[model samples]
Structure formats: structure tokens, C-alpha cells
Target: MNPLVEVSHLEKHFEIRSGLWRTVSSHVRAVDDVSFAIAAGETLGLVGESGSGKSTVARLLLRLITATGGSVRLEGREVTTARPAEMKALRRKMGIVFQDPAASMNPRAKIKWSLRRPLVTNGFEHARIDDQILAMLAKVNLGPELLNRYPHQLSGGQQQRISVARALLLRPRLLVLDEPTSALDISVQAQVLNILLDLQEAFGLTYLFISHDLNVVRYVSDRVAIMYLGKLMEIGPVEAVLQAPRHPYTQGLAASSPPMSPHQRGRQRVLLAEQPPSLIDLPTGCRLHPRCPFRQTICEETRPELRELAPGHWAACHLAENLPAPQPRDT
Candidate 1:
């Protein structure tokens, strides 16, 4: 099966201005030289800390924010440079579930109106949209009564379900889920996840699941990508990368997970101190080397390329030699 979504050498930057006259200017490297792909019906989890540029990648892929560089392709169709007219044709197969349901929804619009917005935008007729809306609502386990209520009247999970329903109104092949469950309670989150799984099984949808929570990623993702600063440090099957992470950052993330039993506790979690460097004046070479406990002289002068450390596994680190070689993950 071919990839449903592909991004290559992607970059996005923000120009900063400071001082009394705002004369001091610099560029913040939000996303830098990133690349990845998602095969049809597969969920690729993008995991990273708050400032690791995960959100930037999401916006760029959706074309909500223009890309400073690189390209994005959907089912081999180029979307990077698509004009307004061209984007309309491509967006029918793509949609995004934002992190915050409230921010994405119109305050004045009823649930039905909100749900039908995307479908109408995609050029569906009123009659066709009504049928699709009701069917989509049912698919998310929502009731017909919800269509008449405002967003405030609905529970958090309900609102999110409506968001999901709206996204699926067009039967998009790919959905960019940006921390879809972050704002909901655990019970609600579980319900949402179950709905997502059921929907995927039913629709055979491809997902780009972005989140900072490794635990959630473990459950929802088929594979995971570890990111730091503005680049991918490691990526592979969720089990392979999470159980035994090859990169120091990824290992740190795994170690951070509490052991279920006292007997299972021994690995030293990488303790990172001090805040990340300012993107406007990023450090030379590897940005992670500054906080990496195993940093060596070479780490400060030469940036390591993302290399295939194992079959379907990739990582970037100069001290990779000091760590154990990539061994096939035992499951």
C-alpha cells in the first residue's frame, strides 16, 4: 500500500523582533528539516515535548499555516504548493481534529450547524449533507437530539464527537488528530479512543496522531516518531521504539514511565535540567546534545544525520556509538 500522506525536508520559521525600536530581529526555527510518511490505514504517532515542533508540522500539513519550505503530498498528490482552488479538491480527502473543541467550534452555531459546516464547505448539497450528518453522528455514538443543542449544552466528549463527525462528514481518507483526547477526562478519553478505533476499522482511515503522551501513543499508534527541538530523533514500530528506545531522548521518555511493580524498577531515567535553548539563537550542531547526559566533544561540533539504525528504525545522535547497537526488539 502506498503512503496516504508524505512530508519531506519540511521547514517552518517565525521572524522575531525585539528591543525598544523592535530593531533586533531573528528567526525562530519552529520546524526544521523534518520528513515522514503515513501509509493508508496506519496511525503514525508523533511524540515530543511541548516545544518540539509537533504542532507546527500539523499546521503545515493541513496548510492552515504556510510552509516556509519543503513539500507535502497526499496519496501522491502534491499539496505543498496547491493554490486556493486546487486545495479545495485535495481537502475533501483530508481533515483535522484540533486539540480544543471550543476553539474550533463557532459559539453561536448549533451542533447541527457546526457538524454540517465542513460538508457544506466541501460542496455537498443540503439534502446530501443532512443524511451524512445524521449517519456520522451515529457513527460517533451521538444521538439525533445533539444536532439541536449548542456546543455549551453538550459534554466535552459530546463536543469532541461532533468535531470528529464533522471531520468525517466528507469521508476523508486521512485525519490529522492533534491531541484529540487531551482536553477530555479519562473516561471520556477512553470513549473517544474506542470511537476512533471503530471508525478506523469501518472506514479504513489513515491517522497522523500527534501527542506528547507516550502512554496514549502506545495505545493508539501502530508506529511512533520521537522528536526533539525541531527534528525527529528516532522512529519505528511503537513496541520497538517504546519498549527499548534507541535514542537517548526516547530512552528518557521510556524511563519516565513508572514501573508497574517494584521489581521492575532499575533503569535510570535521563534527568534533563534547564530550559530548552531559544529557537532564535539555537546552539550549533545537535540541539539535544546540550541537554544529553552522554554528550561528547563531537556532539557539539558535528550534527549527526538521521540514519537507519535498524530495519524500519531511524535515529540521530553522534554518541550512538557509545550506546548499544540496534538489536531486534524482543516482544
Candidate 2:
């Protein structure tokens, strides 16, 4: 069967206008052409620093913001250019869990009311709304006793859990989680992740988990995609790609993740200098080449297309094809 969601060649550009007449506008290449698919019952983590366009991809998929180019297809149906009515009808099976749950919720509304609001909007049976709310709340480790509390009454973790319950109320098969755990404490993050895992199994859900945390990506994802300067630099299965990173950018990121095991110590992180080049006037060739320590003459003149370097593994770097051997394991 085909992937549940297919985003092919999706691009979202912004025109930045500045100075005097405002005619001198330079475009911000927010999401320069990017593409990937999400399989049913699988989680694909999208990782990058701020402004790498991960959130832009999510908003584009939901049509919260219009895309300047490319197509977003859900269940093989086009969404990039979907009409208002069609988009609304299509949204019942799709949901997003925002990073800042407190901000996402209506401060005045009680948790129970907020959780069931989606059901009410989707025209769920009135008799079923209460039961649905309770069941959804239970799934997120929330209870009926807290139902009367407003967003401000709940703790940060509880608020985030409420956000999760609200999104799940729609029974959406596809979930776009944008930094869902970043705002919570570490302990809370684990709880939320576990809850998500249990819920995914129960519902056979597909996820597009976006975050700046590599450790979180390592924990929650089956596969990972690395983005840089609005472009995808590498993508592969989580274990193979993370353990044996190919691209310099990807390796740098992997190396930076703190050692989870006590025995694996003294790992040095590869920190890059300066911010990514301006998106408006990105480097002529490889966008990452300017800061890339492995920069070569060819990297300065050519943009590497994302291609398979090995079976089921792809990276968009000239050196990806000839990466150095992995350090020996302590077998």
C-alpha cells in the first residue's frame, strides 16, 4: 500500500520587503523544495535548528499557510491547493499538537470544554461528546476531576497532555507534532512520549514529529530526516543514520547528542561556526558548504541532489557517497 501522506517537491517561499518604497524585497526561502512520505503506523522525525523550515512544512501540510509551490497529498488526495470547503471536510482525519499547548488552548475555556470542542465542530453526536471527552482525557493520563480546570489551572505537562487529548479526539490517522515536548520538563517529556507511543499502537497512527532535540528524535522516531537552510540534507532509518551518519551536517548533529549510556563517554560535539547563510541569497551551490568543514571545490559550485548512497539510505552531499569508515565497535 502507498504511504498515508505524500509531500512531493513541497516548497513555501516568502518575499521579504525592506527599506523606503518597500519595492526592494528579497524572498526568504523558508522551505526550499523538500519532499518526504509518512507511512501508516510509522513515525518520521524531522530535525533541524530554528529557521530550517520544519514548522513551515507542518503548516503547509495543514494548509494553515499557503504554499508558494509543490504539492501535499493526504491519502493520495491533493491538499496544497485544496479549496476551503474541501480542506475543512478533510481535516477531521488530520490533527496537529502544537509546541506551546498553553498558547494553543483558549485561556477561558475549561479543559473538558476544550477537549470536546473539536468533536462539537466536527458534528459529533451530542450524547457521545461527554463520553468521548472522558475517554480522550483518559488516553492522555488526564481525568474527569480536572475537567473543570482552565488552561491556567493546569500544570505545563498537564496542559500539554490536554493538547494531546484534544488532537486525538478527532481520531486523526495523521498527526503533525511540532516540538510537542520541548516546553515540558525532561520527566514530563518521557511521560508524554510514552503516552504517544501507547496511543500510536492503539490507533495505528502515523506521525511527523518535528523537533530541535536530537535525543528526542532518537527516542521517538523510526526514521529521521535532517534539514538545513530549508533543504533536506539527509534521511534514513533512525538507527543506521544516527549510528553511522554519512553527511557532515548529519554527523555533526549526531556527534552533538550527549551520550545516553554512562560507559560511552568523552564524545566531542562538532559545532559549526556562524548561522546558516541568508536564505534570500543562499550560497550559490550547496547551502551548507559555506560553513562545512569538509568543503571542497565541487561543493562550492554544485548543489547535490538527494540521492541513495546505499540501500534505503539517502543524503544530499557529494561526500556522502564516500564517507569515512565508522569507528570500530567495542564488541
Q: Which regions of candidate 2 are displaced past 4 Å? A: 259-271, 326-331
Say which candidate scores most in TM-score: 2
Query: Could you give candidate 1's per-residue lDDT for residues 141-253 as a string of tens digits?
Result: 98898888988998899889989988888888999999999889978999999999999999999998997667788899999998888889998899888886778777766
The per-model lDDT (C-alpha) reads 0.83, 0.84
Candidate 1 collision pairs? none
lDDT of 2 by residue, 241-330 (tens): 777877877776665544222332234233355567888889977888887877888899999999887776789988876767644222
Relative to the unseen true structure, what is the Cα RMSD of model 2? 3.1
